[model samples]
Target: MDSSENYRVVCERVAAAARHAGHEVTLLAVGKTQPASALRQLAALGQRAFGENYVQEALAKQRELAGLGLEWHMIGPLQSNKAREVAARFHWLQSLDRTKLVAALDRHRPADAVPLQVLIQVNIDDEASKSGCRPADIGALAEAVRAAPRLTLRGLMTIPAPHPDPRRREAAFARMRVLFDDLRRAHAGVDTLSMGMSDDFEAAIAHGATLVRLGSALFGPRR
Candidate 1:
């Protein structure tokens, strides 16, 4: 299918999922490894929020699409050396897995720039290879992020380990929802639950994901 057609299908599915959940869910078009033109095509269809994994690649795309007025998000594992650039560029940081990284982002964020929206990525499935804070460490990290003058703690995010059983995926997403609710009760103004992706976003939504990151479904398998 063409880009426009692909985008339409994804949007429809997202909307349906949101309807099923009875909440508004944001579709974060994962643009990692995609070209500026692909972004422009999506942007033309009224897509504003885009997710990227690599800071350098995102920066290049941001520059290329400077005239488009899109909102970029850093959704991959971030490095200490790359914090400043991510702080200066992306509007949202969804992979905030450590307190030290939070401190770096807060310190380097330009005073004139808007406060960066943040989501504490929780290692829900506790995979050793994943880049997210353990579920037990969320409170401390959330507090640290809340104290950061330049960061706005939006909510929690997680990339659950893929499972063959649909019920297992649902269970993980439901667990994330519970954590998200608990976080909201403990912290004021906490709202977003950035979980889900192309494969299991429907399940994520069914269990209460406010944001779903999509790549292949919208952009046709990344190059």
Candidate 2:
């Protein structure tokens, strides 16, 4: 399918999934390596939120597409050194996992801007290579974010180990749902549970994901 056709199909599938789950699910088009023109096309089609994994690339896109009034999400693991740029520029940060990052982001966030929205990325499967914090440490991280004057705690995000079996994937999503609920109960503004991706977003929604990040599924394979 071409980009327009792909967008239509993905929107249809997302609507169907949301209906099945009996909740509204927001879509964050993962525009990581795609050019600004592609994003402009989608923006014309009514997609305003875009997710980017790399800071520099996202920043460039933001500059080029500044007139479009797009909402940017930092969906990759963020290094402490890059916090200021992300804290000032992106609309959301979906990979926050440590207290030190919270402090850095808060301090660097522009005084004129509103509190930066953030989610705690949980390494649910405990993969050593991943950037998220362990499941057990969510409470502390949540507290730290809450204490930061420039950040707003917006619940959890997880990239579950890609188990080929649907049941195993569902199990991981279920665990994330429980964790999301626990976090919501403890924090007042914890609303977004950003789990799911191209292959597993439906399962993520069924198990309680308010937002899904899609890259190849929406834009075809990266160049």
Candidate 3:
């Protein structure tokens, strides 16, 4: 399908999933590796929420797609030096997995904007390559986040080891739910479990995910 048609189909599916999940599903068009023209087309399709893996790529889209008012999310691994730039631009940081990073985020938030929306990336599979905090450490980090002036401890996010099986994905999502609950008990106003992706997002929703980061499911497989 052409980009506009493809974007329409994806947006419809995403809205349906959101309603079905009883979640305020935020359709973060995972625009990684996608061209600015395609993204501009998609953005024209009433898509305001977008996620990009690389900081430079996101900035390019942000600049290219100017006046579209997209809410950009940094969904990939972030290094220390880039944190300041990211804090200055992106609306959401969905890949935060460590205390030091969290501290850096707090220190760097631009003073004028709303408290930045942040998510704690969880490495549910305990994989060395993936970015996320181990599930057990979230509570303490949430507390630390609460104290950060520039950040609003909005919720948790994760990239579990991918499993096509619905039940297994749900279990991983359920673990996220447990951690979410733990955070709420400790820090009030901590909501949103930003789990799930194209392959297993339905399972994540069934288990409780407020936001789903989708790429291929919406845009089709990236070549």
Model 2 lDDT per residue over 18-134, tens place: 999999999999998899898898898899999999999999999999988889999998998899999999989999988888888998899998899999999998889988998
- Candidate 3 Cα outliers beyond 4 Å, as residue runs: none
Off by over 4 Å in 2: none
Mind giving the per-residue lDDT tens digits that candidate 3 earns over 74-166?
A: 989989999997898999988887888877887788788887788888898798988888888887777777789889888888888766666
Q: What is candidate 1's CA lDDT for residue 178?
A: 91
lDDT of 2 at 95: 96
As a whole number from 0 to 100, the lDDT of residue 195 in candidate 3 is 80
Models, CA RMSD each: 0.7, 0.8, 1.6
Better of 2 and 3 by TM-score: 2
Q: Which ten residues in a row have the lowest lDDT in candidate 2?
A: 97-106
Question: What's the lDDT for all of these models?
Answer: 0.93, 0.93, 0.82
Residue 124 local lDDT, model 2: 91
TM-score of each: 0.98, 0.98, 0.93
Preferred candidate (lDDT higher): 1 or 3: 1
Error of 1 at 9 (Å): 1.1
In candidate 2, position 119 carries an lDDT of 94
Model 2, position 91, has a per-residue lDDT of 83
